[model samples]
Target chain A: MRFFINRDRFVHDVQNVTKAVSSRTTIPILTGIKIVADHSGITLTGSDSDISIETFIPKEEEGSEIVRIEEKGSIVLQARFFAEIVKKLPGQDIEIIVQDQFATTIRSGSSVFNLNGLDPEEYPRLPQVKEDLLFRLPQDMLKNLIRQTVFAVSTQETRPVLTGVNLETEEDELNCTATDSHRLAMRKATIERNNESLSFNNVVIPGKSLNELSKILDDSSERVDIVVTENQVLFKMKNILFFSRLLEGKYPVTKGMIPTQSKTAFKLKAKPFLHTLERALLLSREGKNNVINLKTLEGGQIEITSISPEVGKVTEHIDSIDFEGEDMRISFNGKNVIDALKVVDSEEIHITFTGAMSPFVIRPTDHDHYLHLFSPVRTY
Target chain B: MRFFINRDRFVHDVQNVTKAVSSRTTIPILTGIKIVADHSGITLTGSDSDISIETFIPKEEEGSEIVRIEEKGSIVLQARFFAEIVKKLPGQDIEIIVQDQFATTIRSGSSVFNLNGLDPEEYPRLPQVKEDLLFRLPQDMLKNLIRQTVFAVSTQETRPVLTGVNLETEEDELNCTATDSHRLAMRKATIERNNESLSFNNVVIPGKSLNELSKILDDSSERVDIVVTENQVLFKMKNILFFSRLLEGKYPVTKGMIPTQSKTAFKLKAKPFLHTLERALLLSREGKNNVINLKTLEGGQIEITSISPEVGKVTEHIDSIDFEGEDMRISFNGKNVIDALKVVDSEEIHITFTGAMSPFVIRPTDHDHYLHLFSPVRTY
Candidate 1:
């Protein structure tokens, strides 16, 4: 392969593809990035058998020449060294030439590097999916959906299915849910589908794959197409395609875990409550259980306290914006509550509790589209 | 101790003292910060037995009340939690009260924390050094002097004396040197002495202690008083006094290692040469030895190359502004050269070599304040 391309754009595309490359992969060839240069453009692919990311740079962009191709061929270079070298290359344009025995020469300015390249044929092929079952959503909305639910996924391998986020689509609404059996986070957004009758409820994607995809997608409102198949899902943006394997086994039904009734309810500013919980967690975190107690008092006031026997105790008081129902006390993992409050977009937050020992619900007061549920700890 | 002090200033002083506190210390009391509030002001001290840092906040500074002392007492609180709490406290001023049984209450805004405190009497006492042998130098100059020599200290414990920087004073100049048997760095600066006859030839301060002291001193031209004694060295700043235990033993003689003559010499821009070596090191770093070769060519040109048998090769070419003597080839550790180049303040760097097997020297072209010497590796 022989081509000269713009250095900045090439670096950007390489970084996106390398997100799927893992240094711990057992397959030796998986540690290399596959690059192909054709008449139209150049394509870079990286995969670890579980997640694959491929990005393409065309010969011309916006009436400006981005790449000048001298020959059409393919080569795979070691990802770690190649990425670092290209990022620090000293010229505006980079030229690559492949010689006999797959010895590639990279030249930019006064520096020249010769790297041993592996055969591109040894790289794994990405899964193919038909575009028949496709849906579109704004890039910003998809990023938010991933961020709101991915942190709640179980990190343990004993329940492998719970390590992925469950995506369910009915009509035009898409609901995403993740749970580690201790806390559950659910977010819903309206998506545009090619077929109104298309629906799926068992698509569980690894939370790690969603996190990588979120990093690559910008916060623009441009639409991105997603296609779902029996065992794989593909997210296609401008000139990039991301593929992830679907987890095996059925996801547990979590609708019943959310509380529908409340013995006590209160509304408070999200930011102040988040700060209070953060301070309380500093002490409770030293206790190893991250437990903090909350008690509602007269005159719409709430007291939050945490105690670590060996360290010290922290007490915080915040006045509620509104209060109703019976006064009650409950204890919970402050870290979980802090996570949910950070993603809440509204100014005010509403919390509902059935009792001191049961699960409770926390939601943005201005919207019913997203909510978080937590299982209270028995600290009495 | 009961006092309400400016939260920002309190946080700053706590952070400075906590640098001397380590969690892995064998003594439990050493993990806590000792605070003594007298009629004048409050003093915070932290010690790990080897190094102690104490900072004072008076009742008034520059016509402003910084501390209000309601009572006189002393107590010690856990360094880790106290530092974190004071940094995130939500009020303009923080009130600390030591109750009966050493139970302390810290209040700011609506947040209150009751921490378990230890008796201040158990904290280690700082060494008392007479100020007869005192010298003063600009804080910026001392900071630079430490940075230029500390990185060359030996990290291995086989030779405990080599792990410290040797400081010697004669006349009005202070000379500092550090070496790890392979490379040596020396820096010198002029100081204002209280007694012109006061001099020391064997003051070895631990590299780790100098590194910590460097972080606390800002880059200002204000004067800082330094006093050296038999077993301790004290640095007294405006309201901060830092004491470090000196390392015992005789330092190695390193003056004869730097060559006084040369067979080949060259001068080049410091930044560009640094960039070239950095790029060459990228390939050599993979070989684990960090060895790169430099060969002089005709027309005042130089070639730099590094080869890793299993990976690849990198070749860089540059034109020196000045070249003299015979053409020669030498191989040295690229990382060591890069470190010296980064700290060279002069725009042009001058290098001299006696031969391929002997040690070479690198110095700033503008002055003789600092110089670095490196031993060559036999590659042929």
Candidate 2:
């Protein structure tokens, strides 16, 4: 590729595509980033089999020249070292020239780097997805959904499907659920799309890819176009294309894991509840599984206690601002409560318990768009 | 101990001492912080065998009462958890009451924590150092000297003494030197001491402990008292006492390793040279030793080159702003140069090379107080 491009713009685009650059050299070509310059623009692609990210820098942006391409060609350079060099190069404009032999020269300011470039033909092409089954959603909403549920996805690769977040659509409502068999987090939001009454029952996108894409998405208000095929999913936004390979197997039906009814429910301030749970977590560290007991007393108060035979017991009484139903006691992993409390933006949160052995649900006092369910530990 | 102390003051003191607290709980009691309350004030001490830090919270400060002691006693509480709890606790003043049954009640704001406390008698006693061999130095100057040389110390504990920085004093000059055998860094400053000319030969203080102490010493302008005993070194400042156990054995005579004469010398802008070295390091990663080659061209320019058989070669040229002695070329560990340059505050640095195989010295153009030496690696 022979092009003169704005260093900052090129650097920004390179960083976005680098999110999918493979660190493992198992597939040597995948460790390099493919760069192509044509009449349209300069395109950069990075992929690691599981996910691929491509960013395009147009010849001109906002009436300003961003890139001037002299020759149409392609070359692949080592992703990590190239990115580091480009970032540290002291210049405002960078000139990249590729010779017939695939030798690349990057000159900026007073520094010029001659790097060995690989034949881009050796690099694997990104899978193309049909636009027929496309949908649109606000980048911020999608990012929020990913943040709220992705943490609950199983990190272990033993069950590959569990490591992906399940995304299902019924009519206009999109439900995102992630569970590790222990705790489940689900977020539901409505999106405006051209497709009518569409449903994706068991579509599972790898949680790791979604997390990486979240960081790449800069403008939250911009609507991103998502196209889904049988095995590949593509997110296109503002000259950047993110493609992720979907999990093959069907995702487990986590809907059955969440309770539809509750036996006892109480409203507690999110910040205070989080602080009290943190204190209990200190004591819980001495226990086998960092378990803390939550007891709702006769009055509007919750007593969080953790005990260890050798490290004594700690009890923290937090007054409940609001309460309903019957008083009850339950024990759970203190870390679970801490995780659930972090995403809760509401001043007060309502926690409901179905029974001693059943999963409990925590939701914001005013909204139903997000819900967190925790499987209570059976403490003997 | 029964006392109501200013929470902020107490927490600050506790945090300083807790820096020396051992993370490994092999000796369970060692992980706990010892607190002793007297009629004068409360003293908190944390130790990890090799290093101990003691911080004293006086009963009064700036004509204001900081601690109101109700009784005199002592107890040991878990350092890590206690520091976290105290930092997070919501209160201006914390009430500490030690019961006859060895139960400690720490009340702050609306929260009350009843912790199981151990007898302080079980805690290790602080090492007593005679004040006769005391010296005084500006805290900031001492910290700067430590920072300049500590990073060059050997990290591997194979020869335990090499992990400590050697401090020697002659006349009014206090010299500190550290080396990993491959490279050495030395810093010297003039200081006032009670002894006319005392030499602390082979006195090695652990690099890890000095690093931690450097972070704790925030007020560099304050005077620091240095007390040396047979096996311990104490740095006493206002309300804080940092004690480090000296590493046994003779430190290698690094003075002999430094070349007294040089065959070639050059003056270069420190920042630009650092940037050039970083660029050369990128290509060096492909080699077995990650070595970069430096060559002095016919013109007033230096060429830095690195080549990998499989991954291409990189050549970067930096114009020499100034040159002296003879035209020469040398190669060394790029990482060592980068590390040494990070501590150099001067704009211009003078590099003196004895020969291709011998160690080279880098120092500020006009300063004699600081010097950094790096051993060159054979590129062939």
Candidate 3:
């Protein structure tokens, strides 16, 4: 393979693909990135069994030449070394030439690096999914959807299915939910369905895959086409295709866990409340669960406090708007609440409590599209 | 004790002192910062036995009030927690009050923290060094001297003395040197001696202490009075006093190791050569010592290459200025050369090599105040 490409564009594409490459993969060849140069452009692929990312750079972009192809061929190079070299290579243009025994020489300016390349034929092929688009959404909206629910996914592997976000469709709205049993985050987005009658409810995408995809997704409002098959899902962006294997288990039903009634409810400014909880957490963080206590005060006031037996205590008070129903006290893991509040985009957050020991709900006061549920800790 | 202090200035003072406090210290009280409030000012001190940092905030500075002291007393609080709380506390002024049994209350805005404090009497006292100033140098120059030599200090504990930088005084020049046996970095600065005949040849300061001190030093050219005692060194800055325990041992003689005669010599732009070596190191870093080869080519040119038998090779070429010796080939650790080049203030750096098997010297082409020496690797 012999081709010369723009250094900046090549570096960008290589970084995107490298997100899927694992340096400690059991399959040694999977540690390399597969590169193919053809008449149209060059393609780079990286996979680690669970996730595969492929990015393509065309020969010409916007009437400007990006890649000049001298020969059509393929080779796999160690992803870590290749990525580092590509980032640090000098000059505006980089030339790569493959010789006998799959040895490749990369040249730019006054620097040349010869790397031992693996035979592309030995690399595993990416799963082929039907290009039937399941749904479409703006890149920024998809990123928001991922950010709102991904952090709630269980990091523990005890329940492997909970380690992924569950995506289900009902009519024109798609509901994404993630929970580790202690807390649940749910987001609803209106998506354009390719087929009105087509729907899938059991798709569970690994939280890690979504996190990586979020990092690579652009902030632009460009449309992203998503396709899901029996065991895999594909997110197709401009010239990048991200494939992730579905978690092989049924996701637990979480709809019944969200409280529908409240014994007490109050509205508070989200940012101020977040800050108060953060300060309280400074003392509670020494404890394993970071537990903090919240109590309703007279005249629409609330007090938050945390204590580490040996360290000391922190107490903060914040004003609540439209507090109603009953005065109550509750304890919870402050970190989980902090996470939910960080992703909340509303100026005012509405919180409701069924009882001191029951699950609570926090949702943006201005919208009904999203809500977070937390199981309160029983404190003596 | 009770006081109301400006938040920003208090936070800065607390952060400076906390640098000397370690949470894992065997002496429990050493993990806390001792705070003493007098009629004139409030002083904060932290010590890990080897190093101590104390900062003072006067009741009034210029014409503005920085601290309003209600009573004079002292207490010790956990440094990590106190620093963190002081940083995040809201409000322009923070109010601190001490109650019975050393319990303390800190209030800012609507936030209040009750912390358990230790008796200030239990905190170790700083060494009482003679107040006679040993010498004076600009703070910025001292920072530069530390940066130039500290990186070369031996990290291995087998030779405890090598873990510190040796500072020797001769006339008005203070020579600082550090070596890890493989490479040596030396820097010299002219200082105003407080005593004409006072000199110390065996003064060694721990590299770790220098690193911490460097972080606290400002970039201003303001003169800093340095006092050296039998077992301690004190650096008196504007409102901060940094004390470090001198390493107890004789430093190895390194002056004679710098080769004065050379078989080959050349001058190269420091930045460009640094970049070239960085690129070369990218390939050689996988090897134990990151060894890279340099060979003089015809027409005042040099080629740098590195190979990892299993991986491939990288070759870069650069033109040398005033190349004045026979063609020669040598191999050295690229990382060491890169470190030395990073600290060179001059545009051009002169390098001299006696033979492939002997040590070489690298110094700024403009001045003789600083030089770096490295032992070449033996390669077949």
Candidate 4:
């Protein structure tokens, strides 16, 4: 089995697949990347059990030859070293020859590297998901939804399902939610789909896998086809395919956690509120729960204060152009407020509170597409 | 105490001094930066026992007022948090007011921060080194001398003094050497000194401190004054005073490790050889010593090879344009060779070897300012 491929094209595809390469050598063969060459093109696959990434370099691109398959075959080589060698190769084009004995030789300008290759048959095959349940969405919208909610996901392994973002689809609307109990973030968007009223409630995809996928799909205007199955999900774009195994278990009903009514709400500029929260966090670090008290004073003003027995106290007053409600005082983790404020892009934000102890909701003053909620701490 | 200072100028000085701030809280006060405001200006100091950096912000610079001191006093605040706040402050000028109780109020554009401050008298004072034993050198040359040899210093604390670079001055020549037993790097430069035939030998400065000093002295053309004492060394540049404690005990004699005679010598381009060593290092990761073999063939060519039982083998030939002496072979740590090559700025390099088992020398083809010696590993 042998193949001669253009170095630049091969390197590009190798990098894409290398993102999913297993750093842990638990499964010896998984640490290597599988390379298969045939009449059509060369495919590189890297997997770490939870996520698998495959990139294909065609025989020709835009009427230019990219590869020449002398003999159709497949082999697995160490991903780490192979990628490094390909990137550092000194030539514009590279020649790869795989002998019948499974010895792979890679040669470029003035440099040649021979790597011991393993039988590709030893590598696990990628699970095939039927495209019947596929839905297409703009990559930009999907990336935004992931970034907005993924950071709120529980990173701990105690409740494994909480470590994944829950995606629910109803008719033409897509809802994504992530929560770690202390704080929760959700984003909603519209996508074109033929399956009317289809609901994928509690379909949890690991937050880490989503982040990696987002980094690989940097181009915004491109459309990505997502295929969902009972146990695995696939995202297809250009010549790359990304597959991630779905977390097994039911996601908690977060709908009940978000308050349906508010006793008080105030509209404040997002930047000013974020800066106030940051200042409070600085002072809160010396306190027990990193807690800061927020008081809605008369005449559209909010006072943020924190006090440490040994470090003294700090007080900051931020004025709100519009405020209406009974004056209220509440204490909450300053970091939670800062995190929630970061996801709100609007200049003005409306924050609603249902008593001091209940979870409060914060959203853009004019947009219903994103919502952030934080549970206030009892400072008594 | 009260003072109004230019925010940008204050932030710059804080950043420079914060480099010496201790991350560990073993001595709580060491994590705090001491700020003293006088009628002249404000001085900020940060120290972590091993090194101390002090930066002074003058009341005026180039006929423009940078600081307006209302009252003279001093206080120590947490270095990490203070620096962060100063950087994020919203105004061009910051107003600082200190109360009799030591509660400091820092105000900027619509934002006020009150931090608990400590009495500056508790902070350790800088060591006094007599200015008589001082010499001047170009900052760029000093930085160059440090970078060329500091990497070879022994990191292990087994021999405490070996962890520092030894600087010796004789007549107008300044010589520096560092070694980790297996390899050695030495650099020498001509400088003007007060004493015509001064011999300042065995002056060991900590490797870690030199690294920080190198980063702070970014200007190559500026002149820096060096003051040496029995226990401390000071580098004065402009308004900054950098102090480092000297390493106790005698440094090892590295002169015998460098061989003056050689049986084989050859000249090669620095870039090509460096790239070849990098490729060999990539293949050597599977071996215990990360060893790469180099053999001088009959023709003016050198063969580089690395083999691993499980990772196969790689062999490449590098043609030498100029060569002389007996044909020989040697093996050394690929990492050491790559590091040595990085410091060399010349296009052509000269390598001399006494024997396969003896230490070899590498230097620029036309310069005598720097020399790198590496001991060959027994490949057989």
Candidate 5:
């Protein structure tokens, strides 16, 4: 492959693809990034066992010429070294020429580096998904949906299905839910059908993959095409494609776990709630399960306290403007609710408690579509 | 003891002292920070076996009240947790009250944290160094002197004295040097006698301690008083005292290692040289001793090249307007010179070579007192 490409643009594409390159890959070739130069532009592909990422740099975008193709060829370079060298190259443009036996020579300014590359034919082919089940959604909403619910995904592999965020689509509305048995978070977003009927269910994306995708995804008005097949899901951005293997097995039904009735309810400012929970956690984490107790007051005031037998105690009072139902006290993991409350961007959050031992939910005051539910610790 | 101090200032002092606190300390009480509040202000201290750092917050400085003491007492609290609590406290002013049996209650705004504190008497005593041997220097210059030579200290514990930076003073001039046997970095400065008699020659401060002190130290015009004792060195500032134990045993004789007669000498811009050496190291590091070959051309156009048998090769040319002596090629550890180049703050550096296999000296064009010396690799 012989091509001269803008260093900055090529570097951006290289970084995006390298997210899928892991050192723990069982296949040796997967440790490298597959690069191919064609008439249109250059494509870089990287893959681990579960996820594959491919980014393309067009010959020219807008009025600027990003890449000029001198010849068309393919090669796979060690991803780590290639990324570092590309980033540190000394010129505005980088030229790559793959010679016989995959000895790739990269030149920038007065500096030149020759790296040992492998045959691109050794790289595994990217899985193909049917285009029929593709749905379009705004990139911002998709990112928000992932950020809101993915944190509660079970990190333990004991229940492998819970380690992924379950995606179920009915008509045009898509629901994403993740639960670790003790705590659950759910978010819902609408997808544009665009007349090409797209509806599916039982697609579980590993929470780790979702987190990495959201980290690189730009929060812009650009739309992202999500293609879901029987075994793999693909997220296609402008020049980048992120492919993740669909988790096998059925996701547990979390609909029955969310509490519908409330023994006590309060509408509290989300920021203060987050801070109070964080401070209480500082002490409770020093104790055991990060458990903090909250007692309702006569006039909408709630006192939060965390006591550690070894390392002292912490107490904080949060003032709630609105309160309803019976006054009660409950203990729950401070970190669980703290994580949930931080993702809620509402001015106020409505917290509903079923009882001292049952599940309670903290939801945006204005919206009922998104909420965080957690079971309380039996402190009594 | 009860005191209400400005949270920001208190946290700042705590951070500086905590650098001396390490989790690897054997003494249980050494893991905690000793805090004493008096009528003057509060003093915070943290210590490991090698280094101790104590910073004092005065009641008032330059018409600004930093601490208001309500009662007088002393106690030691776990450094890690106390630092975290003080940083995340919710008020502008933090009130710390030590009750009977060292029960420390820290109240900020409406939030309160009760921590178990041990009696300050249990904390290990700080070393008392005599004030007779004290020299003053600009804090900025001291920091610069440390930065210039500390990186060359041998990280391997094989040579105990080489792991520390040797500080030697003769009359008024102070010289600092560190070498890993392969390369040496030396810096010299004139110390102000200020009517106090101070002269020392056999003190070697641990490189780790010097690095930590330099990191927290401010590069200002203010003077830092350096007090040297038989086995310890104490640096005293207005409200801060940094104490470090000196490494025992005789330092290696590195004076004869610097070559006086030169076969080639050239003056080159430090920046381009640094970048060239950095790039060469990237390729050479894949090989043995991070060796990079530098060929001094007739017109002083230096050609830098690094070749690895397994991974490819790299060649970079550095342009030098000034050239002297015959053409010769020498290979040395690129990382050693790269580090030396980074610490040099000069626009132009003069490099003197004494033949192909001998050690070379690189010094700033304007200064003759400080230089970096490295022995070349004898490649067959």
Candidate 6:
């Protein structure tokens, strides 16, 4: 490949693709980015068996030339060091040439870097996916969905299917759910579907892959097309393509985890509730089990307390906006409660408890569709 | 100790003194900060054997009350946890009381933290300095002096004396030097001396102590009193008494290592030279030796090159602003060169080379009181 591309544009593209390129890839060629240039544009591809990313830089966009092509060829350069060199090279435009035996020369200003390029044929090809089942959603909405639910996915690989976020469409709405057996987070929204009768279900994408994809994606109003296949899925937007493998086996039935009715429900400001738990957790974290207790006082006040014989105790009072039903005390993992509360954007969050022994649920006062459930720790 | 102090004022003092409190301290009480309240003011002290920091807060300052003493007593509370609690407490003023049997209660807003405080008599007392030799200098100047010389101190504890910066006074001039045998940095400044005949020349303050002190001190024109004794140095500033233990052995003589004359001297813009070395080092760092070669071309052009058999090679060209004396080639550890250039504040830095085999020196074109020297690597 012989071309001169804009340094900034090239650096931006390389960073996006490098997220899928892992240094610990069992396939050696997967560690390098596959670079192929034709008369139209250049395509850069990176894969680590779990996820694959391919981005295209056209020769010209909106009558402004981004890359000027001289010869059509292909080569693979070491992704990490080459990316660093190109990013730090001091110039506006960078020239790249592939000579015989796969030797690549990158020149910018008075600096020239010669990097070893692996054979392009050695890199694996990205899996092909059909457009049989496709859906389009705003980039910002998809990123929000990933952020709200991915943190709840199980990091332990005891059950491999629980490590992925379950994304599926039913009727006209799309729902995403993730659970680590202790807590569950679910978010749902309506999306545009290519086929009206398409009812895709049980397509679990690795939470780690969704996190990386979210990080590389830009938060804009632009719509991105997602194509689902039997074993692989592809996300297409602008000139970029992101592919991720689907987890094997069926996801657990998490729809039964969230309760429809509550025994006791109370509304508390999100900020005040988060801070009280944070101070209480400081003492709980010092103890063996990260547990804190919440008690409702005679007045419309809640007492948050954590005790550790070795390192003192702490108690914080949070005035509840409203409280009803039976007054009871509950113990919970303070970290799990804080994590659930942090994502609620509303000023007030409504928490519901079922008989003090069953799992409790927290939902933003203004949001009706999203649900967060936590299993309380039983204190003897 | 019972007092109500301004939250911001107390947090600042705790942070400053906690630098000397090490979590790995052998003395159990040293892991805590000692708080003593008197009729005049309150004092907070922390120590870890090598250094001790004591900061006092008066009852009133500049028409603003900083602390109000309710009783006179002393207690030692865990430094790290107490600092965190005081910093994050939600209140304008914090109330602290040391109850009977050394139980301490801290109250702020609606949050209360009960901590286990140790007996103050168990805490080690800071060393008393006689102040036979004392000098005064602006805080900014002292911080600058430490920054210039501390980076060159030996991190390896093989030779304990090399780990400290050699500081001495002669003829009203204070000079500080630090070297790791491979490179040496020296800075000198004239300060106001209380005893005109005082010439203490054998004090070697640990580089680690100077670094922490520099971090705590603000950049201002206020003068700081430096008290020098037989085995301790006290940096006395506004309401702060910082004490550091002196090294036990004699320091190596580094004054004779800097050459007075050179065979070739050249001046180049600091920014341009630094960028060239940075790009060259990217390749050098990948190589096993981390050595970069610089050669002066026939027509005032300088070229930097580094070669690795497996990773290819790179060459950078820097158009010299000025060159004189001789055409030569020199190889050096690129990291050392970068470290020396980073501290140069001037637009242009002058580099002097004795020969291809000998050491070289670098100094800013506008400053003559500071000098940096680096030994060349012998490449076969």
Model 2 residue B357 CA deviation in Å: 2.4
Q: Is candidate 2 or 5 superior in DockQ?
A: 5
lDDT by residue (A57-171, candidate 2, tens digit) is 9899889999999989999998988898898887899999999778999988767788888999999988977787677888988888888899889989899999999988888
Which 10-residue window of candidate 5 chain A scores lowest in summed lDDT? A193-202
Give lDDT tens digits, candidate 3, residues B260-358: 899999999999899888888988998877999999999989999999777799999999999998999999989999989998999999999999999
Every candidate's DockQ is 0.79, 0.51, 0.82, 0.58, 0.69, 0.75
Docking outcome class, model 1: medium
Instruction: Tell me the RMSD of model 5 versus the true structure.
Output: 1.8
Candidate 4 residue spans exceeding 4 A from truth: A194-199, A286-288, A308-312, B195-198
lDDT of 1 by residue, B260-293 (tens): 8899999988988898888888889998999999
lDDT of 4 by residue, A104-170 (tens): 9988877888888988999999998888767778988888888899989998999999999999887
Residues A1-380, candidate 1: write the lDDT tens digits. 89999999999999989999999999999999999999999999999889999999999999999999999999999998888888888889999999888899999988999999999988888998899979999999999999999999999999999999999986789999999988999999999999887899989999999999999999999999999998999999999999999999999998878888888998989998998898888899998999999999899899999999998999989999779889899999999999889988999989999999999999998988899999999975
lDDT of 6 by residue, A1-380 (tens): 79999999999999889989999988888889998999989899988989999999999999999999999999998888777888888899999999988888999998998877899998888897887778888999888888888989999989999999998887879999999999999889789998898778899999989999998778897999999888888999999999999999899988877887877789999887888788877778888688999898877788889987877988888888778888889998888888878877788889998877899999889877678999999889
lDDT value for model 5: 0.89
CAPRI quality level assigned to candidate 5 from its DockQ score = medium
Estimate candidate 3's alpha-carbon lDDT, on a 0 to 1 scale: 0.94
User: Residue A48 deviation, candidate 3, in Å?
Assistant: 0.9
Which sections of candidate 5 miss by over 4 Å? none
- Please identify model 3 stretches exceeding 4 Å from their true place: none
Query: For candidate 3, what's the TM-score of chain A, rounded to 2 decimals?
Result: 0.99
**Candidate 6 CAPRI grade:** medium
- Per-candidate TM-score against the hidden true structure: 0.99, 0.96, 0.99, 0.96, 0.97, 0.97
Q: How does candidate 2 score on lDDT?
A: 0.85
* Residue pairs with clashing backbones, model 2: B140-B220
Best-fitting candidate, measured by lDDT?
A: 3
- The TM-score of candidate 6 is 0.97
